[model samples]
Target chain A: MTGGRGSGLARLSLNQKTTNRWSVAEAVQGCVRAGLPAIGLWREPVHEIGVLAAVQLVTDAGLRVSSLCRGGFLTDPTATGRQAALDDNRRAIDEAAALGTDCLVMVVGGLPTGSRDLPGARHSVVDGIAALVPYARERRVRLALEPMHPIFCADRGVLSTLSQALDIAECFAADEVGVVVDTFHVWWDPEVMTQIARATGRIASFQVCDWITPLPPDALLSRGIMGDGHIDFRGLRRAVEAANYLGDVEVEIFNADVWDADPDEVVATVTQRYLDVVLDG
Target chain B: MTGGRGSGLARLSLNQKTTNRWSVAEAVQGCVRAGLPAIGLWREPVHEIGVLAAVQLVTDAGLRVSSLCRGGFLTDPTATGRQAALDDNRRAIDEAAALGTDCLVMVVGGLPTGSRDLPGARHSVVDGIAALVPYARERRVRLALEPMHPIFCADRGVLSTLSQALDIAECFAADEVGVVVDTFHVWWDPEVMTQIARATGRIASFQVCDWITPLPPDALLSRGIMGDGHIDFRGLRRAVEAANYLGDVEVEIFNADVWDADPDEVVATVTQRYLDVVLDG
Candidate 1:
């Protein structure tokens, strides 16, 4: 079953964090074993094995790099803070270029600590992205703005809706800055479908996961596997497909249960669910 | 301090849920002691004391009923379920009328259990509200659609944005159906100010609560007092004020700490916060 290649498997990308325990090498091998043609890489794990070695390892395994985990957190209000964030993101862009993936998912930082200035924080995000655009464009890396769920607005990502992300992404060239349509983050948006349609060419990545309720105390780990929660993955998949988003459909689950499970077993489950719940459903 | 009346206190309304332990009579007395001119009523507490007596309690206290807590949960898929919800909402409208508050806050129910059909659930909400509008009009009650934070979209309220709520509310007469502008629910929205301006005279209740991070295990209890978290309450107040929302500014916190605190102290804190953080900040 692991060796059998299917058309749906080609579109499926095992996002590294989904199998949280797996190292970059382990994740790549798992993708190859599961017949997934692609794997999304996270910076920390990629850096663990060294970016050059990580790139060589994935290339040797014949796996496509679907996307890099992130490159944004640009909501700092201080000049020093903004510069540090930009410098780090430049490094992230270099990593994305080295890894041979144009897509660099961006989770813009939330409000500065002890600050009630939401508008100021959001303005900084736009300005930070503007500053990074030329560098990203030169590197041929796309800054995929991720509009996180509103639950993360205060602490994780200030970009709270796909429409809001698109508004910012539109300011730059489509190839320079794009948006991520992650079901876990955006499924509840009333305008999600409308925004997805509008995203068309600007959709850099389409991440799939379910939004489970009774959110654990740690909301960052609240995502469920596609079939385990309330998301209509097939509908979202179809919407993106219709939006001309012919890119990797990265399965990015952040649930503690998925992380705790054996990586091989988790990969098998993702494969089956991606086919059943996301593709064929 | 409780006996001292200030101009800021006149525009303030203590949403009963903020002091979760207070019964209808207790809340009215608390409002009076705080020198607050208005109080937002909850259906369960009103029913607990009998709506008519609760009305008399507030009336004799010389307090105004700013708005009724809720009259929604209308996203059921089954005919029986929908009918039961509609019936319940009609009773809620009656209760709102009896309480001498035209604004019946509507927390349009979330997706039905075991259902991933969010669009369908949202449709049911609109249909349900449409069915309730005529009855509400007859009772001289305004159905105030409360666009809860998107975090509650799956299990509590499908109406996740003020703009989305206004879309449905605008379909009905402005006097018959209106929308709520709750800071905790919408402070993250990039279009919040624009939507608030669009709402104009249709703003039924302008609720304030800060969006604190590290949300508790129960997301429902995530609200903080106006100054305790990241919301810019004064900006929101000014926006609503500019929009000509000459109604009560309700403080509707749901934090466990707030609930467990002495209700009088909480009331005092809310009053002081309303003046310093909300009115004068």
Candidate 2:
């Protein structure tokens, strides 16, 4: 199962925390310095330095781009917002293609403003993805819809379950559309193993994070470090591997404390903890 | 269907906010004075005033007991904790029986402490209920497993989806276990309507509260009052009725603001909102 220790461990990737405190260049350098193999780059930092410069920076540091941070917020009550989101996703895809990332992760937006129509919002997400799949495929970038936790159903991502995400993925004719299974989002799912099996080769990425000790209303801000929270990362890894998903095991913690710490220390501590908790588990 | 206005709207039931501002008797009197039909009593206040006194207060006010605030937190890792929880549940059953409530709602706890075993915690919940079922049934007090939002998968409630709750309920004998579909917890579910149909006569109660804007970490403290947030109460009502759940729709908001307000005003506002937004919708 180790596939030889070094090679197997090399599959670890870091999803730069979404906060602007860390730049893409700095994040790439941090991963390289930590002997980490890959990094999941967020768009804002890349956009700040220009996509070309960001791509060059990663390439120069010999860091693999596992996935792009995001590409979708497709639910818009109006045509103008919806079209604008699609256009932005197109740019995201182009950026991912330039960076040579494995996939472009989509955090599909929640219900449109002033609407409680969850199903309608989901339909809009599917429609938006279907519209963008052709463009994504043309750029050779896989569009991975990240199913956020149900708490975000009101104002964040409408795709709140892996089954729902897989259903949306099936709507497209090609495998270009896939699902990103993040531990923070899905560790609590009773059907996690079954859904992971259903995902199998269709899983574009597998992200890991821990559930915090004290749950806050804005849960997105309080994610635990790999070993800090109660998620069975080892068990999840086994399930994902059993499902034939050989994607990078991306560490994506969103803890406020971790963010406030030194970025280098954050990367080092997370990488070591991921190895001990997940790989060693 | 209001069943025609002359029949009078189904009376709103106030679930006394958990903050320490009001005693059980005070809440009951406030509901009665506000012309509300029912009150859902929590355990702590019952403990404070004693169950017999709380029951007498409601009886004197001619206030119906819609449901007991809660009964289950059965996901403890230790046998001692599990046994104690079952004992507490039995006490809760006695309290509910004394109050003549429609049911004893169960907030089945999440993963046990120091463990990330979700399935094991779920098993504990099921076994706990199985152990308590005969006692509850003999007392003529129904058990209502209330599925909380997925965000509470760690410390609060593990049964986060309606379908999962129904699955657990199906494991029990007829009427041994039913479900409470709180819109605040499940309005975001993609399978809510389908699960409502599946739960049709098996529903012990229906709860209504809006999903708050900018959901905070302590979600229990941020619950929006009926029609205050984004839930389509009319749609939810139609679905619940379609499922043959003819129970009173209990307004169970745990908002800090509502709790800080005058209990009379809270009851009046919730009653008016229930009539205008839910019944009229």
Q: Name the candidate that leads on DockQ.
A: 1
Q: In angstroms, how far off is B157's CA in candidate 2?
A: 1.1
What local lDDT score does residue A171 receive in model 1, on the 0 to 100 scale?
A: 95
Mind giving the per-residue lDDT tens digits that candidate 2 earns over B1-281? 24453244445677776323778877777776666677788888888988888888998998888899788999997888988999899999999999898599999987776887888898988888889989988988889999998877888998988888888889885477899989988888888889998998788888888887787446667788777787988888899889887777788877778778876777668777887888854
* Cα lDDT tens digits for candidate 1, B105-188: 999888899999999999998889888888888988999999999899889999999999999999999999999999999999
Cα lDDT, model 2, residue B142:
84
Q: Model 2 over residues A1-281: C-alpha lDDT tens digits? A: 34464564698888887223788877887877778788898888888999999988998998889999898899997999988999999999999999998599999997787887777888899889989998988888999999998878888898988999999887764369889989989988888889988887788999998887676445668788887777999998988898888878888877777788888878768877877888964
Per-candidate Cα lDDT values, in order, are 0.90, 0.83
Q: Compute fnat per model.
A: 0.91, 0.75
Error of 2 at B270 (Å): 1.2
Model 2 chain B: lowest-lDDT 10 consecutive positions: B1-10
TM for every model, in the order presented, reads 0.97, 0.96
